[model samples]
Target: MTDFVDNVAFIGLGAMGYAMAKNIRKKMAPTGTLYVFDVFGRVCEKFRDEFKSFGPIVIVESPKEAAAMSQTIISIVPGAKEVRDVYLNNNSGVIVAPKNEDRLIMECSTIDSQSSREVGQALGTAGTGKYIDTPVSTRMQGGVPGADSGTLSFLIGHSKPSDTDPISHRLEKVATMMGNPKKFFYCGKLGAGLAAKISNNYLSCSILLAVAEAMAIGIRSGVDEKLLHEVIQNSTGQNFMADVVQPVPGVVPDAPSSNNYRLGFKTQMMIKDLGLGVDAGYATGIKPTMAEAAYRVYENAAVDPKCIDRDGSSVYLHITTTQEDHQE
Candidate 1:
């Protein structure tokens, strides 16, 4: 395994990717070279200019180009299909190798475990590029430019142990570049990372919806919404639903909920993840009632223009308002 401190490629210049790449540039020593690629040319250019002070910035034309130029490639695309298309898909609709065997490919997208396995298998067959799933667990606000200092938990699934593969060690470095390193578990296989992420998100969605429904009941019973939030905060509920993960607004000032659901994590994104969870459950013959419920809640919220602008936290408002109106 080669040191990832020097050459790095980051794909997908969306909110999360942009901030993560910037942090890598700021923290990496030995004057790291950053190769960035985004479908939008404007985004690539903007990042190039913004991080020019760090070191050499290569704005690549495509994922392959970026892969060709860097030793370690990190992808934070939208979903599994996009992840496959960028890393495995070739111009001729076939999968091709990006570089040599020592090269590391870290996929940071939140996707299904099965699809993650497929990508990992393809990379294995190529006998060159290594694949790892290192999905992030932080709201967009947490990844904002200067807010890189904020903490984030990582679920890393590497193909092999760090002692065996130098690539695994380099990935740990990349993980810390984004935020304070939480956990970089060497989950047994390639798809394990995706599995962990899917399960985590499913439970998160379920908790959010459950809290939302409970809070809505409080609102309908004449409890002030703000007061309800405060009461919940002071009670045992605060341990999990309120403190570790808040579902309602004004509870955590820095959370997406407090900001009226703007630019944290979109409801649509939550719906997508829930959908993935549902599919995973069905395939594994496991009950997914909570995931299904969360999906429906997000599906309805996505249709509302106001909710569309709000963060995933806005699900609380939907639950509260709907339940309150029912009683009226």
Candidate 2:
């Protein structure tokens, strides 16, 4: 394994990945190099112009190119299909890149476990490098705010316990560059992180819907929404959404709800993750009733003009504004 990390590659420069790469580039050693890549050439150009002075920023052409020049590679793409294309694509993927026994590849996307395991197996068979699933949890911490502050928490699924091996120890150190040091979890084997993330997202999405419905009920009963929020925080009904990322606007001054839901977790992304959770539940023979209910709400919000591109919490707007609810 590499004793020191001086060259790192970061793929996928979307909402979360952009902020994470920014922190990595800013905090990296002055002598180190940061390789960046995205499907959009302009995004890579913009990132380089904005942060080139901080450190060496090289915009690569593809995932393989990034992997060829770095000892450690990190990716946080959108979905399972993108995950496969980045790591397993025949012509331009990381699997065909130059082999380095010491290289470590981390996929931080929130995706299905089967797809993650398939990529992990291919990397092991090709002897490309070590692979880990490292989906992040940042909604309660203010989503993009958490990523920008380097305070996001990750659910890591690796071959060994964190810090138990040279590779895992290296993983722990690198993860801290983009996440809270105390919050990264070493959940079991290579695909455990994805499973944990899917289950957790299912619950959080459900919670957001629950909070929204509860708050709407309170407001309709002549109670001030702010007072309702205060009461919930002081009572057992309190949750991360109610207190930190309140579904009701004006309840939390800095929440996405207060800012019209732009630049936060998108409703479509929420729908995708919820569908993944529901699929996992059916695959495991357990019926996720609450997740099903929340999934329907998010799906509806994804199609609504007012909530389509807004934050996941904007389901509050969908619920309050809709005159009729679709029956399951």
Candidate 3:
């Protein structure tokens, strides 16, 4: 009631959004309620049941309804198209909703930096709600487990619409509940968060592709897969995808590959994120060699019936399998 921006609504209940929303509810529930809304009502329904221990998880019908009811809105949908639909679409989106100068509209999706800037422009033109792009980093392999533990680092970016806004002051407090408050970094200026996130993800996806291909080559060259992994992990070539989510099975006991690469960041999503990075490069007149190459790798694997739904680590299998097919 007395805290800054007591009412909060989360428009997307996907992995990160759900975790962040749960944390916000746990922290802000006593003072106010956390409103949950998604294009898919089932996600909100399931989230409502899961957050019983926390204060009320109020569900709403649409994004516009969510904005109307809450002082702060956090949306973490997939890409730029979805972002535009949620914030800029006039018929059903939040941009046309009744003016509320006190509200904060935050987009947490990893989209092109230009889209973030345009969305901020739309918000300013609408004359209601300050907008910010708060894209999170791709180092977030924590999945829902980390959300359950409440330890995700967030990056905040201030757009032109948020130039003079004090929404971040409220965020400084609310962000601590979402993850390590100390890890929160303000990138400054609109789309900076998206740019930063895309940059981080570009490294992640590109390294994943490069490492997977390298692993496939090592395996084909008669190098023991797990042994190579251990050597690399102990050597200077180690990384999260190599050491933690090692694409090779039995290399890392907890890696997705150990369990058939069933559940983690999907191959399709990785391709999508990589494409965003590629777009960023195009916008800046720079060639995204690694990112584009990685995108092509993932794109090839994504269409494979086997790799379509598998974890991004499955790119290892994709590479090895393609090489096998080529040899025959």
Could you give candidate 3's per-residue lDDT for residues 1-328 as a string of tens digits?
A: 2334467889888887887887788777575778888888898889889885767778987778887778788888878899999888777788877788668777778788898899898887887687888766544524556555776666678522243656666666666676676667788878887788788888888888878877877887899988898788889888877877788777788888899986668888888888888888998899998887788788888898778888889988878878788889
The TM-score of candidate 3 is 0.90
Q: Taking the tens digit of each residue's C-alpha lDDT, what string does model 2 give over 238-294?
A: 888788779888889988899887657888888888999999999899998999998
Residue 175 C-alpha lDDT in model 3: 60
RMSD of candidate 2 to the true fold? Answer: 2.5
> What do the candidate models score in CA lDDT, each in turn?
0.74, 0.87, 0.79
Model 1 lowest lDDT segment of ten: 138-147
Worst 10 residues of 3 by lDDT: 158-167
lDDT of 1: 0.74
For each candidate, give its TM-score against the true structure: 0.88, 0.93, 0.90
| Model 1 Cα lDDT, one tens digit per residue, 153-224 | 567776544587666667777776775554455566777878887887788777877887787678768998
Pick the winner on TM-score between candidates 1 and 3: 3
Error of 2 at 33 (Å): 1.6
Overall local distance difference test of candidate 3: 0.79
